[model samples]
Target: MTGNAALTTPESTAPQSPPEEPSVTVSGSPGETRRRAGALLALARFETRELLFQVQILLFFALDLVYVVLQMTLQEGMDDYPVLNQVDRATQPEPLLFAIAVLVCVNAAVLRSRKHGTTQQFDVLAMEPWRRTVAHVLSVVPYAALTALLVAAEYLWEALKPGAIGHGSLGELAIAPLTIMLAGIAGVLLARLVPSGFAPLVFVIAFYMAMVVASDAAAEGKWWGWLSPLVFPAYFPGDPVPADLLGRPAGWHAVYLLGLCAVLACVALLRSGGRTRAVKVVTAVALATTAAGVVGQLPHDKAALEAARRAASETPEKVQSCTEYDGSKYCSFPEWSGVRDDWSAVVDRVQSLAGGKAATTALTVRQRIDTSGGVEADTYIEPATTPGQVTVGTRWGGNRVPEFAVGVATVLVTGTEKSVLQDMCDARMVTIMWLVLGNDPSPAKTFQNVRLDDSTEGSGLLLTPTDGIGMTANQSTVVNELLERPHAEVAARVKEHWTELTSAATTTAQAARLLGVEQPKEAEKCGE
Candidate 1:
């Protein structure tokens, strides 16, 4: 045994030694061992072909390609579907791909568990350390190549097609490889690390749930939804959305996810360590590090985020003070600037009435729900899409105040009372109606530190802040009453509507109290 210490490359050359005397195992030269390892790796690819994981990967690839084909066909035929009319081409592709990727990850987890365990087919290879590692890794090669091809074709097709990205640019496709690579790594790495089947199942289920929840909230215009970076697709076709509203930083979020996959991959590496305490310590550290990495770059910019949040809630008056001429198309309402002191009273009232979300401002959205009419009106009234038609009482570029509130409780009253108030300005109902139901005073009142029921408007509504005392009992009745009836019939039906519409200016003292006061504060012809 001592004479053969330098050793032959094969175990077949080993000599027999006494049972009591331990035999010294000969380790080959480093360079030779490396060459042998490369040979073994190449051999592992042969084993990979026989592995069931290969079949699973191929099945998924075929299915994915087929699904893509089906989707393309359906989209082409969407002209026959009413629902597809509103389907945004730029926005729809992202969610579909993300959902499929998540499912693949789940399937991989299931197969990896069965593959690594006491499966008869893999048991022979599992007994050999190097063979197991190389073979398992090689199994993922097909999936990786297929995924790369899928992404490449998607971008290439989008480019070849005319006018693919307009409202939201699909330039994000440039980063698609990074995202897909990270996601694939995460899926495979998780399956490798937690081959228990249950962990990967739980992991993917939670990941998908978070994604869906985030998407729903974003659709509703909620700010919190932006925190879930996964909701947006890596690439979409449309005009470039603003950086301010990119939801979350895709690169940073992807980094966090990749870090998680690294930790899981390390866990898989140590699984063979055999109940050692050191293995336990390694696993614990990797898990802790992973958790930290995922949330580590969590915005320390609380102040910046707060500024964004506040800017979202601000009135035009407040926004004007902060404007630095950043290349934005929408500008501030000049007259509504720097009125902090004026809002002191209004803020108190809003705090009292606000409910639901912990941050009232979150609920008090500075939204512009552009109706079909609003879109049409925007053509004739350029300002309709600008600050002029805003019901939010705030402007992105305006000097909207940091402080403001509304008296929500006071707005609801008897039909007679509401109708009486609504009639004050037959033309100006919508704005004044918004003033009462909305969260802030009009920018026109920003300087005055008061609220104004500027004017109102109405259509086939039984009763709205826009309507006057001629309250039709129901919305259908109101529409029917107006359909063929003369103006005289409508005028005769509304009671003391003019007196009620114009009374708010004289009766209500606070800007918020304009809800209680009857009338359109401004005499402008508003209803259209």
Candidate 2:
């Protein structure tokens, strides 16, 4: 009866079942994966918008504008079209500036939760820690896009200007965006370790200074200098950009930079919570491997860099297009054929002025626009046509006929110098002046302390003229006397003695005597 009463009690009366076992299932599915990816992208977009609103972005634009202004100011006196130079100078500071900007932006974004005392809130969210870190790194894409647009605009503006010469290709243009992304990723990884607001700024500044120093050193061919992002090939005024400057080093550098970004991202990912020790160790090893790969891909020696440049510049398909005029072969790159007509006219005039000596010289004249947008010429007595023929070359900054004429004259008389070399140089200058002025003695009225007869102390020829003052009183007097005579007579005398006048043995005094003009003596001391 007692057992029957116990069975009817509350414990027995309540219906009881077997204890429920917790279901074990996969943590994520396809849909959940998509949702996580979408969340990361959304976070990246949000961070990008926040970054754009910062006052420092405006400061960045201002600094870039200042750089452009400074370049424009400095290019005023340059003889070549300033477009390429302006672009070069304007973009010269890009890597450093963008790196600093991205570093600051990424640091602020990565440390936002901590700075705002929302770490606990962030911890409570179901999102994976690595995804959050990746989102911050992905924010660099938007910044890079905006920067690329601004850079394109700058280049487009230059391209639209009259006489503008565009420099760099689309591939070269990718440098800035890539550099920005690398810097931002690196900054985020650094923030994961340092976590202080000002620390990243200090790091970026120090990095920029180091890059500046390293780039300067790289210009001198130090292999380690190539480690800096700022070490790019540049074209200065009067110097042509080498065809090899945009070659394999660039591609290798891109790979190295991307590998470094990956290593940093992996390191940052490992810093987050919930990663197992095994996962951490595996990631650490990956980071080391990638870092080694980045280093290995770099140009370890100057010779390797040079070889890459040579390969990039090589144009095996380019063939010389030739036109015969006055028994000479005038050859040029096919793309440069547009200047052939003008060059032909100049060659004919020079040959006429030089008379029979040039007619029999079997000259081969080749013209090309060098990588730096400068006019360069190679003139030689063709070996197949003439033995002991001279080879001469000249590079000039502009495309004017006068410059080409001077180059031709300089080439023709290159190796014929004698004891009276200074006198011959003065005579050559006078001859060039006559060809340039073409019976316009009126231009000589604007004269100053022109010292035409003096030789430069070193190997270079002295051709000094400031502003409109290109001649001294003595030079002006001699030029006027020569101009007053009949043009036909002067032409005859020059043609008759062309070879002797170009020879080093012939002094200015001798040439003047041959032309039946009295040579002017040096002016008496001013105070004597």
Candidate 3:
């Protein structure tokens, strides 16, 4: 009896580990939370691996990579001198292919259990359906990360080049990865909402059509355009405005994309039965953040931009930095200092073939960009009314080189771009074209590039980088014949007949005969 009593005593009892605390799972306990997190991470890793193996995902990623490489290496123009700020946007379109792949793949991944008739089976697992939805959303992160790496690599490809100029924006750089995230999250949300196998295809087509329509407004910098995930800026490649003049709200736009991604993720979780207080709070916060970002990205006062533009155009000296290269004053935007040498080389070549007062005249090569009508607007840039000054555009190399060469010759032949703009249809055109093309290795090609029409003996418009001049048929005939002669011999004759050749009253026949070139019968049929 004493032994049984002692065994029955509470302290002396086996204690049985207090019945294991009834094996209760306290809701939101630390250990339980950690276990759920671990399960989520594991499931996400599995999904990411599955996505990596998809043929469509791999194919589109390869295509994006190839497109980026080709644009970097094979595209025409003076890409060696890339504007660093704009280089970040170069990869914006590249990720469209990869993002669509993610969209299709992530959508299929979310719908896999349904398609396989295993949705009920997955419900028996420790992780809830909302957690599974969260996992699906997390799975897209790795692909987004890969896209970020690709964008960074492309940017470095341009930034590392020896001639890259200007400063790149981190805000601008964030666009591609955020775009990928937006696409991937959108896929998960779509699958949860629609649950149809064809939903992704229909979604893609509809989304594409909407973006195509919104692109025109986006390209025009409309406020509503920022509603789109990818906004096309109002500037062309290799023709960017100064960093301060860009006026793009890239920082706010990045914030907008982040908010959009969060909103999509929360809605997807809610659709999958995540109706807890925490998720609801997150959803509210994300919506507010998105609204704030949208408000921040709206177009601001244009008065300041217009005032700045007028200052840049009317009195460029105040805004430009001056550098002396080879006896010429090159006034350009601060970022354009590196390109001054290239401009100076063209100027020296044009001036080398000139005679009389033109040969020794010092020139001012001012860089001009017209952002008044918008960065992408092909607005007419007025010729420099200032004497001894010539206009050079933000573009250089290829046809731009010879066109700029024409501007230099016009400034040399006449006092200012004003004189050339006044329809200088005289014998002076013969002398001007010679000065422009005499030293060119391919004079005929340069001539064709500088003119609107390809005809060798007809009236045509001569192109300049900033403006144009009219060329009479007689003037065209004389200039074309002179190009066929040895450059040195023609240059000597030009110097000997400089006065008559430059005079407004000199006839085309007199100019041609004096230069010892055959007078085309077409010269006699011209008006003056």
* lDDT (CA) per prediction: 0.37, 0.54, 0.83
Give lDDT tens digits, candidate 1, residues 1-528. Answer: 866766655665778675796755355678766866776677546544543344444564566677656645564311222111112223223434543454355435435447666556645552343234434444444544555466556444444443232222232332333334445445545655655546655766787698778756644445455445344433322212223333343444445444454454455445433344654675577567545544644545656744543453333334433222111122233322232223333433333332222113212112221212211122111112221122223221122232122211112221122233333323223222232333344432431222222222222222211212221112112222233334333333322232343334532222113222233343233231
Candidate 2: segments with Cα more than 4 A from true spot: 1-27, 62-92, 150-172, 212-222, 232-238, 245-248, 274-326, 329-404, 411-421, 425-428, 439-473, 476-528
| Candidate 2 Cα lDDT to native | 0.54
Task: Highest lDDT: give the candidate number.
Answer: 3
Model 1: lowest-lDDT 10 consecutive positions: 374-383
What lDDT tens digits, residue by residue, belong to model 3 across residues 1-528?
Answer: 999776686666645553344577797999989988999999999999999999989999998888877877796556777788778876787789889999999999999989999988986787888988898899999888988898898899888977777778888889899999999999999999999979889988998887766766866757787788887655455356777777678889889999999999999999999999999999999999999989998888867867777787667788999888767899898887888888888989889988898888889999887766777456778888889898987766677888888889888887788886666666778888998889988888778878888656688888886677887877888898998887778899998888898887987788888888997675344333
Weakest 10 consecutive residues, lDDT, candidate 3?
519-528
Which regions in candidate 3 have their CA more than 4 angstroms from the true location?
1-35, 209-222, 234-239, 275-288, 422-425, 454-459, 472-474, 524-528
TM agreement with the true structure for every prediction? 0.40, 0.64, 0.86
Candidate 3 residue pairs in backbone clash: none
Looking at candidate 2, what is the lDDT of residue 44? Answer: 84
lDDT of 3: 0.83
Residue 75, candidate 1: alpha-carbon lDDT? 47
